[model samples]
Target: MSDAAELGAFLKARRAALDPADLGLPPGISHRRVKGLRREELAQLAGISVDYYTRLEQGRAKNVSDAILDALARALRLDPGEESYLHNLAAPKRREKPAPRRVRPELQQLLDAIQAPAFVFGRYLDVLAWNALGGAVAFAFAELEERNIAKLSFLGDRGKELYPEWDAVSREVVANLRTEGGKHPGDPEFARLVDELSRGSAEFRALWAEHAVREKAQGWKVLRNPVVGELRLRYETLRLPDDPDQGLVVYHAEPGSESERALGLLASWIAADERPVNTRSPHPHAG
Candidate 1:
């Protein structure tokens, strides 16, 4: 449950998930004993001694300097998001307590100003807030438990129906959640979410076992909008510089495209619908 154990488990799990072929390692003749890369292979790729890597995995060594962390990150071919997770795992504890639950005020302003479908999410992919257009685009929000992205993506029955490419989105969500779990294995909320989803959705359980991890950035999604039928929108995860742990997810479409037209239609629908009273308290970081 300690941070070090969480970091070690994440590294090991990610390493085990990688196929030798994925990393350009030769496929040995004998049937592989482990699922992913072995300790020796990972050590070779990382330019570290196998003994050292083993110690790190065992959580027996506490000398994880920046150099070693960087080396391991590169060996795994981690993207910027995963690399950030690695650094956060190794960071020293702060003296002050972390902020309580809620979206920051500045983030709220940023979300409100955007005309496109957009929402802010916490480190755990919890929906902090969404703009009017964003809410309109995802009407499934009403059925979702607290508008948590992970919960909606996995547990919400309407979620699968709402997404055009339900299976692919489910896998991606589970993969990202797995990645977060590795980085913060001891996080109570993370554990609770994983447990809830795993029990609720068979699809989530299968994807979780695949050991996939993905950065939540720009991607395309075909959403089945109740107002406009189906719209293929491009979504981007905008990382917040000051907060570091939160990001604004903005969805847009190419000009004059069907997607754009659909978005406009959704906007009109939102304007017509009765506005729900905002009950969410202000997040501490809200400036």
Candidate 2:
């Protein structure tokens, strides 16, 4: 979608998610007719006119001021990530042509050196690179043809079994994808992935429609591995400043927990195998 169109959809979604009763906006038949606060209510809260707000939502407004965007963000109760997304949709920069991302040799060395589960995700959440233990703990990155993380999360390789908290994990995956999609409006690869998932999974379609933008940083990840049963670990997502399209996700368990021992066992399994796939995991940007 165009940035302006997306800007409008985002405004509508956020407005639909709020409650007039909580804000004491004098609920009545209109409140019941619509799901959330009326457009006029939101415009009043943001100190804008109803006509102007409607224009903004219809993608008809141009050269919007930062003050207006800020007010809208505050009125919508957007989180930092969502707020950033809102700004991107309001004022987009030059579009970069979709290009394939490659994990540098040194970066791959770093992944191999780390004793934890570490892998790299590309612009569309493709598993671009991973160490031995990383592959073992998660899905075998070497075994898959399409290593896109979002696709695996929703459609392939018994991923639901791999992620015990499937519902939360899947929702967060869609949100992250949404954030990426917003950054590069009209990206064909993103459109392909979205179309594919929307056709394959009903739940994914519902979450995608919600327009909730999220970027994963650091969090507790639980995995139910066929090899090691339930393995709980902490994960950190590190983005490369030079290559904004790539991010490294590293996972570790607590020092003395069974989860740590599970990592050790996975390490042993990885050490025994010699999968000669390209560890850099070079994949073409979705066509």
Candidate models: Cα lDDT each: 0.74, 0.84
- Per-residue accuracy of model 1 over 1-287 as CA lDDT, tens digit each: 46777677768887976778877776563388878788888999999999989988887778588998999999988777777677767776444334235676776787778889887777677767777788678754433346667777777687788887888888888776665555554566676777888899887878776556677778898888877888999999877787756778899998999889878877777677796624243333333
| Cα TM-score per model | 0.80, 0.92
Clashing pairs in 2: none
TM-score, prediction 2: 0.92
Residue runs of model 1 more than 4 Å from their true location after superposition: 19-30, 93-100, 104-110, 140-145, 178-186, 273-287
Tens digits of lDDT, candidate 2, 252-279: 8999999999889887876776755445
**Among these predicted structures, which one has the highest lDDT?**
2
